[model samples]
Target: MADDPTKKGPADRTRVSTSEAHELRYWSEKFGVSHDELKRAVAAVGNSAEKVEAYFRDRSRDARR
Candidate 1:
């Protein structure tokens, strides 16, 4: 069967945490955004991966406008 396009893969998911250099580096590279951005997103929302992803998603949508 074909992959379910509606389901986001693990890589697309954001795992949030405070700036531990290696973890920060990992997430920054994972999301294709900088540490500051990720940190800000985590601050704005708590460190739930799904919330962080939604934060970025909303930011991206706003940016497109």
Candidate 2:
């Protein structure tokens, strides 16, 4: 475990935590999404990073159509 998990990144990189502002910022930027969009992704997919990423990928693929 990191002394400061927020700064070092969470031990569980597979999940996204909206409770931490830093984490919200980190994920949103990482996924090229707005904070609200990231929150919506988490809400829709239960905070699993892989699912959120897939959600975006699917959305992008749909949008390309």
Candidate 3:
């Protein structure tokens, strides 16, 4: 089955669904970033949530320098 539109979060927690507004909101909130930032991260890396989170961690470290 497809994702439930009424769901608050993504059906698959391991991936980011850029095509879904709720997915963007959920991921952005979880990562404490804006929607655009999340989208950029997804694009730069891939849809893998683990990779996206790792990308943010790396970015955070880079920002500290």
On TM-score, the leading prediction is 3
lDDT of 2 at 44: 92
In terms of lDDT, the poorest run of 10 residues in model 1 is 1-10
Candidate 2 per-residue lDDT, tens place, 6-55, comes to: 58466678999887777877788889999999999899989888999999
lDDT tens per residue, model 3, 1-65:
27677888888899988887777788999999999999999999999999999999999999999
Please state every model's RMSD to the true fold in angstroms.
Answer: 9.1, 2.2, 1.3
Which runs in model 1 stand beyond 4 Å of their true positions? 1-15
Off by over 4 Å in 3: 1-3
* Winner by lDDT between candidate 3 and candidate 2: 3
Number of the candidate with higher lDDT, 1 or 3: 3
Q: Arrange candidates by lDDT, descending.
A: 3, 2, 1
Residue 18 displacement (Å), model 1: 2.2
Regarding TM-score, does 1 or 3 come out ahead?
3
Per-model TM-score versus the true fold: 0.70, 0.86, 0.89
**Candidate 2 — what's its lDDT?**
0.85
Clash-forming residue pairs, model 2:
none
| Consecutive 10-residue window with the lowest summed lDDT within model 3 | 1-10
| Model 1 lDDT on a 0 to 1 scale | 0.69
